[model samples]
Target chain A: MATPVMDKAQATATADYITATFRIRRFNPEESDAVIWEDFQITIDPKERVLDALHKIKWDTDGTLTFRRSCAHGICGSDAMRINGRNRLACKTLIKDINPDKPITVEPIKGLTVLKDLVVDMEPFFQAFRDVMPFLVTEGNEPTRERLQSAEDRERFDDTTKCILCAACTSSCPVFWNDGQYFGPAAIVNAHRFIFDSRDEAGEQRLEILNDKDGVWRCRTTFNCTDACPRGIEVTKAIQEVKRALITRRF
Target chain B: MSTDTSGAIDGVTLYDVDNPAPVIEPPRKRTKKTPKGGGTNFEMIAWLFMRLSGIVLVVLVIGHLLIQLVLDGGVSKIGFAFVAGRWASPWWQTWDLVMLWLAMLHGANGLRTVINDYAERDNTRFWLKMLLYTATVFTILLGTLVIFTFDPNIS
Candidate 1:
């Protein structure tokens, strides 16, 4: 005998009432036990974000559960973690979009030291950013008046300014994961911003710094970084432009 | 102030000598082998290609240079007729076709590897690869069409 299908109204109501199980990977250095993954079941609206579910779990069920969140709007660049085997912001991902009946695997981003359950030490990742000297430098006395720039000049490097300092691109890179010194995609993307800027006179110096063995030359162009960026920055194109610039000596 | 010479004992000049410290050991050289990233196998294949393509490119490029520049009395000999004459022969046609296919594929693959390593957004990667593959397909198709469809004596 065939079972009768539920009507659209009934289906919607059932989905709303269903409780989903989330299997999250947890680790704490202080615990000293082997990495143990625990499951947390929460009754939530399908529209709720994974972050919300996590908060509910933290607030009601397990105070020991830990994760990091700030600017819960995804602008702070915090809350990046591995969900369903891909790097994404927990705040941006909806539980409905993932497998809800089965346990969803959640863990911290790979290729960084795990500071706690879901928080990884972001210092090393930021250190690479600092080394890239993500700043604008100009020679001669500061202009008493505003320095003028053409509209075209501004548009040239406009896309690079969208980076949110999220480690998504860097963590997705196999090369960066293996060799910490590789400037990684995020740093190179920032370098490309100034290297191509018409007003910048430091292009050559930056290119020389990046042309070393650990610099842009290390990029194999795997395109993984591109797939991981939430900001939709064209990191590969920027890197290629940098490579061309280095080869041709044209900033 | 009175300058007094020390009693002229054995005439000796005191000197402080600084010898160059033994040449500081050079920083350890990075191994030539590609770093053992997650994809050692893939890297090995890529390294092999750089060498192999470099070799084939040398031959194909040299022969191309010679035929275009040196053979048949240099640049003036090149015209529609020159290309027709070369392609009329099976051997030359095969050579040109192989060169065309190999060079284009090699360059495209190398570039694809580069794109994957850097593009940071999912949609961006998809669209860029689409563009790359499209261009490669177009060029290969056009080249193949020209190679086989050459008409030496068009009306």
Candidate 2:
């Protein structure tokens, strides 16, 4: 059996801080046309989140470091960046979860124009969302009380309702990265949310929109969107469901 | 202190209200050619066809591989005589013909999707698909003809 001294020392070592290097892709149009990689070495606890490290860099090291983040606990869907070549929310990823022994690489999400260091032009992503008519549609007179639905009907689209409009899934899609015209996985996932709702009467219209050449058909079912979604939504399955709905509508 | 009213900091021109950058349209935005809320369901049908034909091709292709490569004498048994014997039967002729058609169409549709995904330019996509369709048609027709017009006795 080991002595108590070793146990106390082990506990102290467990709480000890280690130095981590963050390699971030920085692009400032005012500074230069080329994107530059800057490394920041910080002494941090392993249990600290990546977002905390970023804040430390911005606050302590460089005041010009820019990144979009809100509701730092993964609710706002912001702060989604390419962490180690994979799309992940900085707030949700811990420093030690990823191999911090090597320099951690961070960049803006792909398939969108990088406006600054980590911010991307999101107008295109939102435009696709609007084109799908994501809101519920009803033609009849408003019910005096409320629109009632069965438990099963509500459960049908429950999986897709969790979308926070984060561009993580859309940016990770290879098809979208190659061709921006393709309505990405996030747009299809949003359409799935409305198309399957039993109360929504605009399923046919949404189906028609998705049946276009650049809509749900563009999805090759690569499952990258599913893997990139920070909210844990099965985005590829939702796209497949929309494709199925389109087919069954015809038959 | 001199104020920089020219919207240029040092030497680079600042893109501000005074010197605005050219507007860039959002990708895939609707236009005159893009009709709203109405389009054909050809892609949906094509997608469904791929799935259905894929299931059928698994049986057809595996059965074909087994017969041609793994049965009785394996590859050694396969020659002009074996092909002639198989083609002599109407059932075998029909089987080969269906397999040819399904495999070609399935492969063509899959390539069409690949071309659509990778080829960014319009003319490139059109020409590539045209080439694909031309090849697909020629192969399908030649295969059908060979299966139908095959003669058992050839000099």
Candidate 3:
């Protein structure tokens, strides 16, 4: 229902609108005693991503600005940060998603060690995955051919394989932040991938592991993790199935 | 030409490969503990709910036990007539209804928390939550139906 003239006028209006500021949280281990916030003003197109704005700021204004980014297209799972008190991928978030008139606050995700400006240490996150033994385990000698799986069997565990290890789900989790030993959402999801897989032989052992007090039992679903996930993974549901599995001793 | 001559000849031996030493590197030590995020005021309300529900559960459970096991000369008194008599009173009906609703909600919320903490994949999370919510709704509806539509006597 829109005409070309109206679209052109709208584009012009968007381009002319210039007052935008980003309030970024900065922490320097060597110089400052505490984390401090600094604001940067830049004129940008409305269609540009928040990542682009950050890049402009780092390029033209402050050379000391630091952040991790790779595969700027959302797949690599890097550049996960807290924007306006929400965990999101910077490259995927457009400026329009946030209030341009207000000072947009950017910070690192909580419950992780901040190595620098926006980068947090992901060692602990990966360590939790390791604790869950997130790999397929087969009973005997290696198969000479591809392991045969039916369509229904493959579909059963299909939903759990889309995790990109962005840590959005894990960091949004209250239990992970509260108790470090709680194996977190991502780890459990990974475990579910193998546990539910038809090719895996370690389902019982993995179930026993997850049945520990601090394992699957610690989840108190707040749905925050589900909301914060950029990949739109359903984190809470997998945990429920795990709970059911523990209770009924069946998938 | 004897063993003593051979030992003397080995004085200038360049290499000895008898023992293989174990290579040990210090374990990778984590520098600092991960920091916990800020707690919002919402946590306080959740804590309060747990305490209140726990207290209510104690009362409901005790009353349930007493009525079902000890009152009116024990289990033999718990036939259709006894149930009908209890349901005839508004207070007893309300009590059972309240217990049913509260316990179901409490258990569901607790389980919901467990799910959020563990499920990782987006689709998995979605489907699993769907299943949980479905089961919870079904149970609640069935329970309410039974409570309100019980027939005292069937000819």
Tell me the deviation in Å of residue A79 in model 2: 1.3
Give candidate 3's error at residue B95 in angstroms. 11
Q: Per-candidate TM-score, first chain only?
A: 0.89, 0.94, 0.91
lDDT of 3 by residue, B67-129 (tens): 899976988788788889898887988899888887887787677666655565557668888
- Model 1 achieves a DockQ score of 0.02
Which order, best to worst by TM-score? 2, 3, 1
The TM-score of candidate 2 is 0.88
Model 1 C-alpha lDDT per residue in residues A1-251, reported as the tens digit of each score = 99878797686875665598988887654443235678998899878899998998999999878888899888888988888888888999899999788888888887776656788767667766766667887899888897789999989999888888878888888877655657788888998888878878788777766765567767878898888887888988888888778656631
- Model 3, C-alpha of B33: deviation from truth (Å): 13
Reference contact recovery of candidate 3: 0.01
Expressed as tens digits, the lDDT of each residue in B1-155 for candidate 1 is: 13323222254322212421122111211232323234123433454466588789889989999989998799988988788888899898888888888788788777775665556565876888889999999998999898899888888
Runs in model 3 with CA error above 4 Å? A1-17, B1-155
lDDT, candidate 1, at A202: 84
User: What's the interface RMS deviation of candidate 1?
Assistant: 20.3
Q: Fraction of reference contacts reproduced per prediction?
A: 0.00, 0.25, 0.01
CAPRI-style quality class for the chain A–B interface of candidate 2: incorrect
The local lDDT score (0 to 100) that residue A201 gets in candidate 2 is 95
